[model samples]
Target: MTYIKERRRILVVEDDIDIADLVTIYLHNQNYITHVAYNLEEATKLLEQRRPDLILCDIMLPDGTGTDWIRALRKSADLPVIFLSSRQETEDIVQGLELGDDYITKPFDPDIMVARVKKRLRPAPSTSENMVATGENVWRDGWLDLHFDRFEVRVNGKEISLPAKELQLLFLMASRPGHVFSTDYLFERIWGLDNWSDVRTVMVHLHHLRRKIENTSSTHRYIITVRGIGYKFQAR
Candidate 1:
């Protein structure tokens, strides 16, 4: 959000002088510590010097395009980014989506702009309130074990290697054992964007999760789909 930067850091990569100034002014009003770069060299230097929480980059830069920058950044990091460009064509939007979170056309409204920024800026709720840990790892029944401090999980007494998104999905579900989470709710809480991704993706991950951790013969599958509703992790 352009208005609240207390816990947020932002990188704005735009080659145009006027637009870059506009972006900095808006972000400054929001209280976010903002850095502006007009070229890939400056952006790279800023990246190596300061780690921003999110990046807003223009598609066309003096040194290179946003797509190239995205490809480079994603090689080592997972920072969310929103593309800013004058190109409004479908292909342009699609290409931008490949970059990250959201895309906005040149003539964007500040309110909508700030809203999208805020959505990505907010942090996810933790597994527990005590950010500081006591060192002992805990599990909820043999179904799921969380290393309260490490944010690691164990299922069926075996450690499961899950992708980033799947790991987030599992941790959120196990945070409240047996609590059924609707697709919309899960998407919002886990992905930070409501309906941004298809429900099928969630289903696929859950299916994979079950196959990996649950026995078909067991009456209680660790993650149970509610059919018409959504899914829940069986507490025990």
Candidate 2:
């Protein structure tokens, strides 16, 4: 008996026909199922119909910028998004990275693009093995709860969607509460050396993580800044 392996589905959201075709070709060559959407409206419709494993979105779309669309998408889904845009300015890249898992500039190598898709789609560990070797899978402290196995985070009894990287950062720190993880170390640990993004990516993700986990009304902070050092998770 033989079992068929399901090909990972990827949504290619780009307005340029040439670019979209080029990307679809490369993705297909890698045995991936690809769906092409020219604008935000089409992308939205496709999203509603098919759940792709990953998305390669162009920042500038016919209906709206991908950044704005993803900002809204993040409210419900923690799906992985990679921005494929020609806008190489610092501000544009920063804004894109703030809302996206990865940003790849245009005129990118098809090989590199396929590589990134593979990286993002790589399977994570099973629930039983998702936690740190010595850390508990579930952490519940009055106001916050982190379920590592389920990749779920609840604050004040409300569940919130945390992107992949943000969840990883939270779990890493939470696994060994009180241990200060330097920005450089955190960046290297989460993003890894293969990524070309700057170290500030760590700060960006950390800011977003804090916002989701910490209540705005309360003065309490689960992740404390060490002033000159890095950050640490304080359960107390």
Candidate 3:
């Protein structure tokens, strides 16, 4: 009997040939379709050919820094990125975190890298099964209305557009109002089941989401941070 595997395409952007080959071998072992790009130029060509499910990038490249590449890519693409680099300094890690979804220091374990990749590629939970319905793909709470199918949110009849990730985060929290979600839980549920040590990913995305949905003048916020815990949706 033969079993066919679902290949999740991954773009590996690393200048070092040995490191790129090693990472590609590991990703292939995990049944992922891996494409290697030696620099930003090569990566750009590969991206034009086919968009990968995720990107594993090195901070230092022959042509330019990964930070610059991702900054430009984010303008058009919403693909998840993980930074794998030898630069483990606080500032370097913070820079990677700000630009990408996840960051890994160099001399990393192959298993851990594969795990992170798998998590990023994990399919989102079924919206139809889990979402609380107002009507069709819509979920409503007074002035705040979410149209999941349309990926549109309306606040007091005013429609606001959000990035894909931000919109998903809002839908998850708003679906279960008053339910407090821990960083780990939200990370796995929303971002996937990788390492939660770097919870900053959740914070950054949530901050962006809040900016879009939260009314500054209003005393009550739609999404409330639970201090020591995570966050919950509180409709006012």
Q: In terms of lDDT, which candidate is strongest?
A: 2
Q: What lDDT score is found at residue 178 in candidate 1?
A: 46
TM-score (C-alpha) between model 2 and the true structure: 0.52
lDDT of each: 0.72, 0.80, 0.78
> Model 2: residues >4 Å from true position, as ranges?
1-4, 122-236
Candidate 3 lDDT over residue span 1-236, tens digit each: 32233346788899887798689768766655567788999789877765678999999999999999999999999999999999989999999999998999989998999898888775644545433434344555556777756668997779988887788788767644454678886777666755644668888999988877777786537888899989977755
Over 27-101, each residue of candidate 1 has an lDDT whose tens digit, in order, gives 655645466777988788877766788999998888878888898889899998999999999998998898789
Model 2 scores worst on lDDT over the 10 consecutive residues at 128-137
RMSD of each: 17.6, 18.8, 18.4
Q: Which 10-residue span in candidate 3 carries the lowest summed lDDT?
A: 128-137
The regions of model 1 sitting more than 4 angstroms off are: 1-5, 124-236
* Pairwise lDDT winner, candidates 1 and 3: 3
For model 2, residues 138-204, the per-residue Cα lDDT tens digits are: 5676688877567788888889888989999997777545545789978987898756798899889
lDDT of 2: 0.80
Count clashes in each candidate, considering only residues at least 3 apart in sequence or on different chains: 5, 0, 0
The candidate with the higher lDDT, 2 or 3, is 2
Question: What's the lDDT of the predicted structure labeled candidate 3?
Answer: 0.78
In candidate 1, which residue pairs get closer than 3 Å at backbone N, Cα or C atoms, i.e. clash? 2-30, 3-30, 4-30, 5-31, 5-32
**Best-to-worst ranking by TM-score:** 2, 3, 1
With a 3 Å backbone cut-off (N, CA, C), the pairs that clash in candidate 2 are none
